[model samples]
Target: MSDLTDLLTVPVLDRSLQGALKAALNGKAKPPGALGRVEELALRLGLIQGRLIPSAARPVLLVFAGDHGLTRSGVAAFPSGVTVAMVDTLLAGRASANAFARVVGAEVRVIDAGVAADLSGRTGLVQAKVAPGTEDASVEPAMTLAQAEIALLAGARVADEAIADGANLIALGEMGIGNSASAALLMHRLAPAPLGDCVGEGAGHSPEGMARKRAVLAQAAARSVATAPLEVLTQFGGYEIAMMAGALLAAARAGVPVLVDGFIGTAAALLAVRLAPNARDYCLFAHASAEAGHRLMLEVLEARPLLQLDMRLGEGTGALLAVPLVQVACALLSEVAELADVLEAAG
Candidate 1:
């Protein structure tokens, strides 16, 4: 896999960008700006882009789909086939992510990163297959180092193409069965917390299923720690997780704003941050997910998400929901008239 450090470089928000936004906001007809968080988001975005004017034109939603090896252990409530089914749903524009992206007017692209099943002749899909499936992490490493690298590169390439397509802002989402287990494993590796704390009831898992998921994650983590290095993400991480890391890194290097989704996406963000410390500057945590580990991951990154709707859906729904808020911020900063522009009444 490409060294995340080599693949991504973080962009710092320029002080001048903030100054421009503050000036724009203060100049608005309203008293020193009462636009609230919208104004704040715009200013932050301006700073993120180092421009007094930030454009969110051609926003692209990249939805990466894959299957996790741990699914074979029956750790999730949904069957492993759900991974392929959901990917097909996404490609058919019938999934939640698809609907959300459509509502937000963002173009959506689905990437089949490493689904275990064959999806031949799928229309409107980006065929970036890395492997047939990951190894069963409970028994051994989920994937080889080479497979992990391919997944990352696939994500990076998608981001590059999106940028070329004129997308200045990017949002990430994913579809994968048993991905929660992979996410939990990555969280444990990155944060070194208790397995139970890292685990969550994914895809409507029952309490019993949740327990089994946690046990599987614990076992996978133990095996990975004993045999794999920190870079060996394939041991316990999902292909989607690795690809999301790659896309984030690619976005960082391209100097574009990246809005991250929930727990699985957060795990990928954590990996990206670990590989490239500077990447954090370009990233915006879209929301605080309901997943227990998401908060810990956000805390580790010292990130402040824009929303906290108890959202647990993994289809970038949270990020898409935050889009209007960002747009409003820009509008207020750029369109609102300043107090100075107002005329005093003639006595």
Candidate 2:
């Protein structure tokens, strides 16, 4: 990787269309501001596309899967093998995300960011593993700087390819059994919050399991005082989380709207924003996660999510649920008649 830091560049969204887009939205054949956040989303899409008419017709969900060695420390209710299994389920189009994507008319692609198992023979899986899996962060750094760079660059490349293939809307989600623990650690250090606040009951962990997860995360936090974005990611993030951050940056660079999923995804967004503040401009938070510390994460990013279904599933399911809403927001902005036009037609 030749100075992969340059790949993190994300140009701020162009604001030239903001005024006209707002006017057009206000002029739509409805009560002014009647659509609530839908209208706001329309304006955001217009500004992102730099046009009065934005498009969400080609939405693609990139689900990155990885494994974390921290599972060995009893941080999750499920085994790390679940990550590989879920990757297979996603590729087979049997996951909840796939079902939701089918209903919303979006494409799904599964990327093997760093699953511990060999997924070589899996059909329709994007092969971008930087390592089998990350090392246990509660003991040592999750991954070396080079591996983190590779994972981030791989994510960017995957996102760039999706955009090149005409993905107007990019939705990001991740699969890793121990990843919520990893996310909590990332948020604990990067958001500079109390570790207890960041830790949550991932996958319905028992009380004992939750306590163990918290203890392991506390250990990880005590081991690292690194607050820099990349350093924190290198210290505690999973491969899929880094890839999601990479993809977020890539979407911002391409000026595409990004629907960030739940807590894990938000943690990645936080990391991405820390890397490039302007990247936050292109992000549309899909939903507020029910997971612990998610609200704090959103607050730190100053983000208002599009939905609040009390959801904690992390496979881009929440994002897929918000896809049709984005489409409708774009459609209303582009296809709705102006109030003046409607009045003149009546005459």
Candidate 3:
């Protein structure tokens, strides 16, 4: 057994401050819960931070980039090389995630979890490649169990480093061709949903292409009966997915809140929550992805996403878009005056 599993124990959030946090939010100048989900957000942040006052200072978005050998099995519409291209775009600060990070005052770092091409020596990218890319799951396990363990540990360390660098909040994203296929497979086995329900037109596919994708995924499913979290990950998960799962576990262990992006990110969260249920307490769903099976995945996780712009693009773009809301939620709790104070001042 890998030591990574032993290190994944996430203690439940200390809810001892829940009542006081709720009281503080209720006593804010506006009517109780007027901020709607924003109030809920503040409460969650307060609970995670263990104080009435919470902070979103130094928000960091870690975009894990990898490639999937499943692409060779005709599972994706784009070539695997796009993963490397997008990594370049992100490192050049020209990706959608980077642009959103700039507007919301967050930092973006791309991690090369398992891109097929050699990406070492990149100035801004973090090096944590588990393999060039996973093997085709339609033919064999996506990666060895050992490789999966390494990827999980790599993700945990990446997140820990961000927290050490003053990141009060972590927003997760991913860049990988055919990862939606990997996510769909992970969801199929872990969510235990029907394979058809988990399959979607990832990156846009034609009718024949979609059929081919479904067939390929069915083949992958038939190849394995492993439903355990780590087993499922080894059987079907991409390195980026495994790493995101690790990042979530590490963030929960550190008591830092995480902004989970769309379908792929949620799949990673599902794997993490399965490994350590307490990790769910630290995850805030960023948006409802337009992918076919995402709603069901969110249902299984019992998460309410903050936004739903029909977004399915991966790259932590949705997570970065939610950063301002998190900051506002923190500010409302830490800076807004109480109703009693307002009444006293008026009197």
Candidate 4:
């Protein structure tokens, strides 16, 4: 595992970034300040990125797909095969994320972290398989520490490669049928709350499914409480969630801004924050999702999301939608005129 302290040393803000934002805000035009959240977002982006001219280029949307053994325990409404099918749909450019990425001019990269089904010879997918599937959480641990480390490293490596490939902005998304259960489990362990509070209906589960999910997660939490955070992750969290957390850490270290999507994404951000508290500096909450646990996760992270469209589509759709808003913020900050530049002296 990489040294968490060393990874956390990246600068989150600098004078150049702040100065550029101030200059943009002071440009001649409307009132001293007219654009509210937009201007704030621009400045915040600059500060977090430590860049005078903040521009997200070659934005990459990383969708990590995996399957949880807990899915077989009747946690999710959808079957485990849905994960593989969705991965295929996403790769075929038929998913919501693909559509949004096409509309926003961003590239999408799908990684097969630990799909239970075979995806051999799949095109347009990055095969970084860590395991066939997570271990059955209802019976034993989800994954060994070694497996978890491998998955996390794969995610970090992907972020590094994306940066090398000219991707200046990163968005985290996931595709696992029972991931919300894993997320809730992680949240219950990491946050200062009860498991019931963190638990939610994942993938449109019914009341009974949610109840069973909570019960199973409670048991898993009890069994893993004695372990460290990473240990708990290896034992109970899904591979995609672990990878998403690693990606967030890598993005922070590489000085790239990160946009977080809904519950699954927020859960990863929460883990990232725990692993590297400074990583929070580079993260931007894209939106408030419709998922019940997502709001709690966002609250725990103390994030002010850009939109509240009540979206729960995961797949980084919310982040993709927020991309244009971020760009508009930058434009307003850089191009909009200040009163001084537009109004003549009192004469």
Candidate 5:
């Protein structure tokens, strides 16, 4: 959304049942607050569901893939083509995300937001191409406002489809070479974090490589002057990131609990929050990444992630790892036998 006010029609989570949800948690056999974050998570889920009975049981992970013009500038360790190749790998169900989805029993959905290469015939690919990719932000705005709009709309559509398919929990993920550079720029714009502090050795950049990235990104930031959130997204965001931002807002709009992945996905969530500050209430920060800037972004949002795995892998794998926790939280509220209920039945 160009202005977050435009998207305020998206419903905020109704907390009418929070009292009952918490009472249920406290009434369990364990002492009050004994379940720790588990109680908090369950209560949050109930608030989102608008009922004491909640379920994040049927979850879907959407992996948005794109190629970045900045990848041509030697910003990333791998070639831009790897973006497309990795999509193929994900479709083959051999990617790390796929393995983890199996662990959490979540379905994986891949969307081609703006991959540079032709992936027309690829089965299991959602072709929502905004462009082959955006122009190199170091040289020019990465995308037109229209392109950013398209990406945002496409992302929202993906979330709508997921929700339609019985998905109550959605995890965000992406594959875009040099997207880390894009994410770093997003952080510098939205937060007071210095550009150097936001820069990280994404995907194994060497010390020298990281310096080059920091320099290039500073220029990109200087070139970008848009104060509006969508304009900022157009200036420096990757297609996959743009879509994820849209998807996150859409998920929040649909009242679906979002399991946000690390770094790149977090950047998307960051953009969504900037567009709609209330969207933050809908997201569950999945984990903190190994990336240095990740903590900076997390701090900006005041997000406490569920896991501290030093992982920088971007395929929604981190978010997938957190899915079981969500399921267990749902089970705690929906299936766990309460102390009062047991005692009443025995009496």
Candidate 6:
């Protein structure tokens, strides 16, 4: 029953095993620094696990879907209905995230946190609805403080369930239509960056549409009374983003590294880091998204994502694609032989 502030107090990753892991990596059959970042990735895994040879199995990608009232306005190019449709696509294994998850042998779990439409009784969907959808932030606060807390807690619970189900790695993503607008606002607020820099043609908004989007977001930001991170999240962020922020903290608390997805996911990570600064240690940015705001958000987080595929898809596809890279890093630590061991075997 701990609150967000209490949850933020999760212990930092233990670094006592770093020396042993580094020694083991250096002693590997490969030449020094030959594996490059993979070796560094291996060391990070060990630090998170407090082990010299960390391992990962049952990687899971949790995609949280919601809707924004702004979609009903003219901020985005696509209709809000596309959010629910994409969720269906995700559930049917036809979406890009599904395809990537299959390739990585990772399980995909979708959550209905705040879709505008009813998605209950859907097979393979976790029902943790915070609301039908958030209120239009351009006119008012998107969600109440209590509802925001609920979304955050729901995210933490979903993450707890994933870990309990034996997932050692979790990749977080979102699917709220007009959410890039939401993410843009959150980035502007949290990164304290230029509004113009944060605005993007999410869902392929045309020049005119992008300009309209910018205007709508500007109005929303002026109305935003979100001074604190939680306030910013509650007033301007969607349920998916709030939940992912909570999920990021929970995953880090469990000492599991989160493969944070694109712009939307990075916004959540930014809020999580703002609330719990140590949470950054538990996240691996999945990619540098093509979204205009994502690079600045990633820069704010000081993250070097595993890939730069120029991906902007928000269904956790980018994160899922980076899964094998992390798994391979863990595998290398466990399977690669020490040069001394190799020499002894040769003798």
Best by lDDT: 3
lDDT tens digits by residue: candidate 5, 1-347: 34334444466668788889889998887788988998899898888777787898799999999988887777888888888789999999999999999988999999999999889999999889889987899889899988988888889888889999899999999998899999988887876578888888888888788778877888888886765778888888899999998888888888889999999988898888888888898999999999879988998998999888999999999999999999999999778788988888889
* True-structure lDDT of candidate 5: 0.88
- Model 1: residues with Cα > 4 Å off, grouped in runs: 1-5, 11-13, 226-232, 343-347
User: Candidate 6, which segments miss by more than 4 Å at Cα?
Assistant: 345-347
TM-score of 3: 0.98
The predicted structure with the larger lDDT, 1 or 3, is: 3
User: Using alpha carbons, what is the TM-score of model 4?
Assistant: 0.93
RMSD of 3: 1.3
lDDT of residue 341 for candidate 5: 80
155-248 per-residue lDDT for model 6 (tens digits): 9999999999998898998887899999999999899898899998777978889889989999999886576898998789899999898888
Error of 3 at 237 (Å): 0.6
Which sections of candidate 4 miss by over 4 Å? 1-12, 344-347
Note each model's CA RMSD in angstroms: 2.3, 1.1, 1.3, 2.2, 1.9, 1.2
TM-scores, all candidates, are 0.93, 0.98, 0.98, 0.93, 0.96, 0.97
User: Model 1: per-residue lDDT, tens digit, 87-133?
Assistant: 88888889888888888888999888888888879999898888876
Where does candidate 2 have its weakest 10-residue lDDT segment?
A: 1-10
Error of 6 at 330 (Å): 0.5
Off by over 4 Å in 3: none
Error of 4 at 102 (Å): 1.2
List the candidates ranked by lDDT, beginning with the highest: 3, 2, 6, 5, 4, 1
For candidate 2, write residues 1-347 as lDDT tens digits: 23466767778678988889888988999999999999999999999888788999999999999999899988989998888889989988999999999999999999999999999988999999999989999999999998999988899999999999999999998999999999999998888798889999978888888888888988888898999999999999999999999998888888899999999999999999999999999999999999999999999999999999999998999999999899999999878988998899999
- Given candidate 2, what's the lDDT at residue 320? 93
Tens-place lDDT per residue, model 4, 49-154, is 6765678756899999999998777778899999999999999999999999999888999999999988989998888889878987867889997887788778
